[model samples]
Target chain A: MRDASRAASGRKVCLLTGAAGILGATFCRRWRHEYDICAVYRGGRLQVPTQEEWFIDPLSPHAALRENDNPVFAVKSNLREPAEVQRVVDLALARFGRIDLVVNAAVHVDRDRLTSLASSSDLLDETFAVNATLPIQLAAIVCRQFWQHSRQDNQAWGRNVINLSSMASLGVVAGVGLSAYSASKAALNMLTAHLAAELAPIGVRANVLAPTSFPQLVPTSLVADTVVDLDRSDLTGCIVQLDENGLRETPSAPSALHF
Target chain B: MTMPEPRTLQAVNDLQPLLQARRWRWRATPFPHIVAENVFVPDVQEELARDFRTLYDQRTTAGYNTQHDFLGTSLISTQCGSLEVFISPAWYALFTRLFGINEPGFLTAGVHRHRPGSRNGFPHNDIFPERLDVGPGRGDVLRFGGPVAGKSVRAVAILYYLNNGPWAPGDGGETSLYWDWKDGVDTPVDSVPPRDNTLFAFSCNPHSYHSFRTNRKRRDSVISFVYRGVDDYVQLWGDEGLRQYAEYGRHHA
Candidate 1:
């Protein structure tokens, strides 16, 4: 239920999860235009940023486009906590009033052996909680905001959600030690597909940025590429790739000879 | 701890007349490629011919696939008689010429070893990804491409074939260069076949896509070396960091 008014006006609002990490920071710094950004990260830990601080400044890359002079709010709250995700959503809605693009790049890694034949029983539990559950929780919060905004202002734009997936999710992990990490990423990919399907009518888009691991380990190049790719997706479900950070945002016309 | 004999270099120089007549390494201006006919010395070739049994045994003993890529491929190594091996000063000068790093910030003069296989190696890139702190220009478009920050980097690869060995016709194990794609088989400029001790050298990058057509015969090995990061220009190939991307392909090779 996009607010016909905003859609007609063409003002796009965006939000990004995991704003502090290396990749998130890239989004916070590089992608600053095309839409109003609401850069979201679990940064504050205990104290979430106030509405003006978190939603308006938006931690996105371009400082000039910020609502105020320096529009960036580092809100620290875990997506694993449903309530926390909701709170941030509420603040974002209250401040600038909409979230058009959501890049959910936050993920927790397990240092232990996941595919270890001798591991403990809690492997599945921990993996799902961080990777799958966190995205779900964030989605619940965003969807709620989508509905609430539609009801309140009667406005919306084609909002998108991009989740960071992993290479291990597709095939076996190369390193025998990366089983738990790999399985969790795989689960995250499926979650992204499921949410994209359910959150369509609201003019909200959900997608995944499945990236391969480079020696750097963090991903800003990947997210930046996804932003470029998402511009073209017309259907309800889309799974884009962040090939070595060469993501783009073109609509449906096969992209140029990307590296 | 023995030093590689210096006469091996003379043997390579002597073969240059016949090699130049082949007119290899005559294609590209910046990164031209070719297979030098002579890869190893007589002594090195002999060592390579007899090294596989030891190499294969090492793999099973380690309980891993860390073994070699093929069956009968042999090996040859060279050293300047120093344990602390590094790039040569001359190659460093080459990096300064190739990349616009201006300053002599790179280390050159490196070498490597290669062992050919009876099978084709997967298509891959040799460079590693580096981190750059990107800043948005104007609105929100962070155009990322080329050099970032102050870290200038350059990598030069030299492959010295230790064994020319014999090759059957249509064995198809030639190094293929992919200039761009067409219909299906990427348009190739060069596809050097495996011959006796041969040498290959080139700069590496996204545009430098290369792979062996096929190695469906005896194994092969090359003595390889790299002179890397001798300049300021670095590559931001932008292959995103997604391991299992849904639509886009793998990033690092």
Candidate 2:
């Protein structure tokens, strides 16, 4: 049994997108002990509830762990709107006082049957906007407003932005119907790489986690643990892939173009 | 001109814990300065912002340069009386404690309204060679009296931003800090936007070069300077080097 109020102050705060999704909820439930999660969702409701009911059995081995306290803050905001994005960041900062990590787990998959025929320009645009553009926008506002001038000395506060990517982005999944989805996720990967390169000097990390498939080959808990590991490691500008063989990393190539 | 609302003693007392809890960590690079975010609590922040908007809408006059206009008030404007009476001593004590100054000091404060699209201003450090007609008492302001002997040295400068609305990226009113005036206005070591209820302050030195960036919208802030007497000035940079530094600032300004 953990005390929620007491533990919240010492725990790092994570602003997680896609809280209603499987991976996002799992991450929240699993790491709610280590972090106070600001769970963000657009459509569906976040499934994790507070510690109201407890399943205690005297005969069970894990009976001592029956009592629980959840430290998840749920917020509904459409990331497509820049104003909504700013509001979400502001609310999180107001509640938690600081956000040490950002998890971009929100995804958009085009459902139009005509997407395979390359006829859905609007669908592609919306998908790209949500997946690629929104992440950068959120990153920019949070970095500028929340981080401020305090991180100037390159102090490793473990401040990071982690994007959940699909293996389809890496061309491992082949389907004409998934073209828009794959392209947008790939753009996110590259954008994360660029963001990582730019923010490295300031001691802020950005990386991507490319899973072969959620809950299919990779268990959701493994993916969550991998996020924690990636955040803890010194690695930046690398794509860590999860598959049957376990995690493998591919470092991003250095860019020749300088601003 | 419509008058601004005054900040009450109750407001200052309400903000005491927040200000006390804030760690005034001074950074040394570019220049010695401290940046404090969320400087006031929500209600006080809102009230101060409203007062600034009232003053800007009614009282501001034509600017000295094309870059910014002025609202030349006393050491503290009667409109925002609590800023000097109740709030400024907090800052004065903090700066003096940080610098370990044991002697007496004074402050000069005014409101500045930078016009939108007015981007062409030279970088300057506010260390003029002229003597401050005001004496060594707290809250004394420069009255610009007839020729006096010694220089009035500025020890610290603080800018409290009081914008009420949201400040977007493209609607840029940023206080650009530079490593040196030779670096030009384009290359700033750091650019602090005029965010609502934020405070940016720096020690006054020869290398403390700063200027405004292109503001797509109007920029408003309360600018205040903490000063020490001529003895401290002569000790820092002898009487001889005063004119040289002043000339350098004048040439750039």
Give the alpha carbon lDDT tens digit for every residue of A44-146 in model 1.
Answer: 2211222232211111112333323334455656666647777878877776676666677777776666454466657667676777777767777777756
Model 1 ranges off by over 4 Å: A1-11, A33-35, A43-70, A115-122, A148-156, A214-219, A244-259, B1-253
Docking quality level of the chain pair in candidate 1: incorrect
Q: Candidate 1's error at A145, in angstroms? A: 3.5
lDDT of 1 at A152: 29
**Per-residue alpha-carbon lDDT of model 1 for B1-253, expressed as tens digits?**
1214333322223322222223222235213443345433454445544443345444332221222243322121222222111133333332234332244333322222233343444343344433422344322111113333443223444544433467765766666665532212333444556665565555655455465554555434433333233233232334421112212123222
CA deviation > 4 Å runs, candidate 2: A1-169, A172-259, B1-25, B57-72, B75-79, B85-87, B135-149, B237-247
Residue B172: error of model 1 in Å?
A: 58
In Å, residue A211's CA in model 1 sits off its true spot by 1.6
- Residue by residue across A1-259, what tens digits does model 2's lDDT show? 1111211235678999988898888888888878888888885445454321222221121334423456478787888875999999999999888887888999898855443457547877888888898887788788888775656422345677889888888984544577778889999999999998877666677888888886888798898888888766656788888887888887655651111
- Quote each prediction's TM-score: 0.40, 0.50
Candidate 2 lDDT tens digits, B1-253: 1212323222323335434224333344567665666766666666666766666566555235532333344435345533443235555555555555555666677767776766655577766654666545634363323123456677778888886368987787788887776678877766777887777887777777787787788787877777777677678756644554566655755
Query: What is the DockQ for all candidates, taken in turn?
Result: 0.01, 0.01
